[model samples]
Target: MTRASYVRRTSEIEHYFDRTALAAWKRLTGDQPVSGIRATVRQGREAMRQTLAGWLPRDLTGWRILDAGCGSGVLSLELMARGADVVGIDLSAQMVSFARQRAAELQTQRSVPTAGRVDFRSGDMLDPRLGRFDAVVAMDVLIHYAPEDARSVLEQFAERTRRGLLFTLAPSSHLLRAMLMIGKVFPRSDRAPAIYPTDPEQLAGQLVAQQHMSGWRVGRSQRISVGFYTSQAVEVVRS
Candidate 1:
């Protein structure tokens, strides 16, 4: 796709999420009753969170985290709870609004320190001017990208992160890829610009070739379904 079409696709996805933020929130991580796919997704999200917790610095008292495609700031809230400051960005204004509101509510209820609070903005991650952070996170955000674009994104992420990056992608396994394609038939999944399965090993190669980083430690995050995997990359020499 041309740059113009790629941008248009992202804009269209933003509009879709803006319209469905509330319902999507309920399905993804909201407190409402859930079953089937919603429950399955939640379980997967929790597992990813656990993986991230282990990947990040154990003591984040003064650390800064960048949450790209933050959605509803769910992970941002978790980071704040651990005393890490967060700057979150989402393409949809509606999603940003909800994220900011929820961040405020969580801060008030949890009585977390101000230094470790989170703030959100509406912006595209592909915007080149976004600054760096101690660690960068883009969870389920790359799901919309085609393969080449995803690789480009990884290189960009390498520059934007100081210590590490955390993300999830649908793997390139044929069975998993087919399941994802079938899932797209449902409107809930179809709203995304596209569902492109990725190979962690190949992506790691891209990172190594393009970003000159070969320290990624990848793992399977979507066990219930053969659909997704997560990757965590940090300097092997970090103290």
Candidate 2:
């Protein structure tokens, strides 16, 4: 494999986390505002929320949910508030810090003054330290690896999941590719170097090959004036 395809180290992801957090916070709160990044964050958040809404149960009480590569813990925090036991892991230390801080802020804002049911960890998705989760969601991630490595990562995700999986990828259409290209050219985008453009079909095939799921269902929503598609896959495992 080329050096570009090598898995990015935690330090690299941490730097990424630091960059995106500043942008996301500025966009979300708008107290410290950037018109451009705010637009990007709004789009991304909408895409992520649409993806999460597709796979998540109407109520997740007492369920175990894992957010892999969970930057800023957006879905993780939401699931915890719904009474799921949530665990968020990221290779980026900065992301873990941001998630923890966000969780704290959320706890303070609630009328019940309750804490979130989330545990944040700094670790690679491939590491065994993560144990297992009932459902795992990794959004806007996995595109950083080469196609082969991406398949391996999906296999790893399958091993850890007891119920379902949800994830996002760049859309397969030519229009969507052009849109992503334009977005990448935006100032300070900090795009992942090895991000090979892969669509839901390719990813679904990979998961099926690993027996992670019998098949995958594709869905999408628009964000940031772009189309973001999600792949939802389910595997039946015998107890």
Error (Å) of candidate 2 at residue 34 is 3.8
Q: What is the lDDT of residue 57 in candidate 1?
A: 66
Where is model 1 more than 4 Å wrong at Cα? 20-22, 111-115, 179-191, 211-239
How many residue-pair clashes does candidate 2 contain? 0
Could you tell me which residue pairs clash in candidate 1? Answer: none
Model 2, 187-233: lDDT tens digits are 64455432446655656655665544554333333322332333223
Candidate 1 structure quality by residue, lDDT tens digits, 1-239:
46786687677778778775456764566667776766767777777666656667666888888888888888787787778988888888877887777767766786555547787889877666667677777777776677677666766677656666666665666765776677777786445455677765566556655425554444333322412333232221112
lDDT of each: 0.67, 0.61
Leading candidate by lDDT: 1
Candidate 2 regions with alpha-carbon error over 4 angstroms: 1-6, 9-11, 19-32, 111-116, 173-194, 211-239
Worst 10 residues of 2 by lDDT: 230-239
